[model samples]
Target chain A: MLEFLERIGWFVGLVLVQVLVLSHVHIYGYATPFLYIFFVLSLNSGIDRNILLIWAFAIGLTVDIFCNTPGMHTAAITLVAFLRQPILKGVVIKEVEEEFEPCISTMGFFPYLKYTLLCTLIFCSVVEMIDTFSFFDLKELGLKIITDTLITLVCIFCVEAVFRRDKSEERF
Target chain B: MRNLLDFLIKYKHWLLFIFLEVISFVLLFRFNGYQGSVFFTSANVVTGKVYQMTNNLTGYFHLKTINSDLVQHNAELSIQLEHLKEAYKKLTADTTVIEQMKQEALMDCRLIKANVINNSTIHANNFITIDKGEADGVQKEMGVVSGSGIVGIVYQTSAHYAVIIPVLNSKSSISCKIRRSDYFGFLKWEGGSPEFAYIKDMPRHSIFEVGDTIVTSGHSAIFPSGVLVGTVDDVGDSNDGLSYSIRVKLFTDFARLNEVRVIERSNIEEQLELEESVVNKER
Candidate 1:
């Protein structure tokens, strides 16, 4: 119950930050980091797949409501949620615990980095594709997808590092 | 029946995923047709309230720049007032005619002041949410303009908030003409930059220079004639090779937009009615 409440808190916090603060940051006129995806990225691996999809749909729809782009985020984030389990299985080593959440400390830095990079790339590409809905400006679309992925990846890593420090301190 | 039930349970997650994706796409495609729903948009009560609170905090940071802009505008207005006074004295011979024209212009429309609560330019179909809506006389298709120049037309409105489809959106097409030559075209944003838009369908024989000013042609009822749009930045041939596509540098800095006024055209319904009557007569 307490874990559920904490998850809910993180959901609200991330959505607010994404909508109010990060959404306004258009770095170099191309990159707008979508850090809200970090919530789904940090969920426990053992969680039910159906529940995970529902959570992703909720988050994406919330963002869509705020940003006035209905279903654009919904479709992208839903696909990410559906693919998360397979991607995690492929990336992580075999010895990890079933209920363990994927983070830098648990999955090791390189594997975690690879996992995040792949997920962010997929999320950004889907989002940019839906936004433009056409390959007419392939150069611009490619630039946006790359920049958004890099910026969002950097943000996710920074957030993970902060939480990782907190968990490590609790161990001491 | 047993086998069917077992299969359904076996791949329930996959089925759920596909179902959700199909629903999402439905919402995506249907959104353009029914964009006025308040629940799915930022103009809804919850989103509007949150944005209003944030704007209050962020509004302070822009005060310095807004003040300077206001001061410059005030100075320019004072100069114009002085020139108008001189012109009024010289035109006293035709004073009745000038007064009649002034009254007619004033009677055509009124301005309703509002603040932009939320705005975005990064998306291909950018939208702006304002603090005023139906309660404040704002309605769909009304022209929205900032102090500097044209902002956009109102797309939707709720009880106390409204959404504007700014010039940055691909769906937005405003009628504009070159100020010097009066040759007109449909201004469109092909996505990528907020600062520039392309004016399509200008006649091939139209003569316009790079620095020529563009303004609303007033061919439509939304904006009155001669509202400042932008200045011509470049000229190129349209894809069909029959007309010119001129690039315009927009005057309103949408990135810094704060306050705006919704033009309430008093005669809009009457004019629309008259036009419809003419069409019906022809039919």
Candidate 2:
């Protein structure tokens, strides 16, 4: 019950931070770090995939509502949630524990970093591609996707570091 | 049936994913297909309120700049007022024609002040939201202009806010003319830099040069005659080469725009009715 409330709190907090704060940060007129993806990324592996997908869609739509981007956010985030399992399967874990949440402290530094990097890249690509919606400015789209992905990764890393939990706090 | 039910249960997540994606795609296509659908747009009540609140917070930061702009405009208006008084005195002393003064008073437009609450320039179809709306006497299709120059026409309005299809949008084409000559063209914003726009359909023989001033022609009742639009920075041949397309540097710096006035042209319906009657008679 406490965990559920915490998840709810984290979701709202991330959305507020994303819409009010991060959306204003337009660096070099290209990248806007979508740190709200951290909410999706930090969900426990033990959580039901169905719930995860729903949560992802809801959060993405919420972000869209704030930014006035109709369906772009929902589409990109739903893509990430759909592919999260496939991506996770490819990442080999030596000692898999039940209900282990993926974080730098829980999953080790490099593995967690790789996980976030892959998710952010895929998410950012879908967003920028759908936004431009044509190949006319592929160069601009590519630059925006890459820059935004890197900046989002950096932001997510900082957030994870600040909110890092001790091993005792792990669910399993 | 039991086997099918089991299969459905097993692949429920995949089904859910596909369903959500299809919904998102529907929304995407629906919105992009229709340019001015205000239902899901930021001009909606809830989002409009949030943007207004955010603008209220951030507007304070721009107070000094806005004040300076207002002061400059006031000085210019005062000088124009003085000139107008001198002209009136000279005309009265010479001919005693009250008809000229009455004709000048016949201008039916009124300016309502408003602040831009939200705006976007990155999109091909950019929109600007102003603080005034229906309750504030702002109606759809009304012209919005900054102190510097033409901004756009009102696209949609809620109870408390209104959205503008500004000069940056591809759909925006304002009738404008050369200040020196009667040669006219339609101003168009092709994708790219926001500082520049193109004026197409000017005749090849039209007498024009770089640095020529362009202003609203008053051909469309949206904007009155001689409102400062832009200045021709480059003169080039049109795509067909039969006519000329002039690149203009717009007077209004949209990136720095904070305040504007919504032009309410009174008696537009009566004029439209008269024009419609003339068209009917011609037919």
The positional error of residue A55 in candidate 2, measured at the CA in angstroms, is 2.1
Please estimate how well model 2 matches the true structure, expressed as its whole-model Cα lDDT.
0.84
Q: Model 1 over residues B1-283: C-alpha lDDT tens digits?
A: 9999999999999999999999888888877775547778998999999999999999999999999999999999999999997988897877788789789878888999999999998888899999998999999999999999999999989999999999998889999989998999999998877899999799999998999999999988899989999999988899999999898999999999999999999889988898889999999
Q: How would you encode candidate 2's per-residue C-alpha lDDT over B123-207 as one tens digit per residue? A: 5667788888899999988889998999999987888888888998877989999999979999999856779999978998889
Candidate 2 Cα misplacement greater than 4 A, ranges: A95-97, A165-172, B1-3, B35-39, B91-106, B240-242, B270-283
**Model 2 Cα shift for residue B213 (angstroms):** 2.3
Residue B262, model 1, lDDT: 96
Computed on C-alphas against the true complex, the DockQ of each candidate is: 0.76, 0.53
For candidate 2 chain A, the 10 contiguous residues with the lowest summed lDDT are A163-172
Q: Can you list the residue pairs that collide in candidate 1?
A: none
State the TM-score of the second chain for every model: 0.95, 0.86
Q: Which stretches of model 1 miss by more than 4 angstroms?
A: B34-36, B93-98, B277-283
The best candidate by lDDT is 1
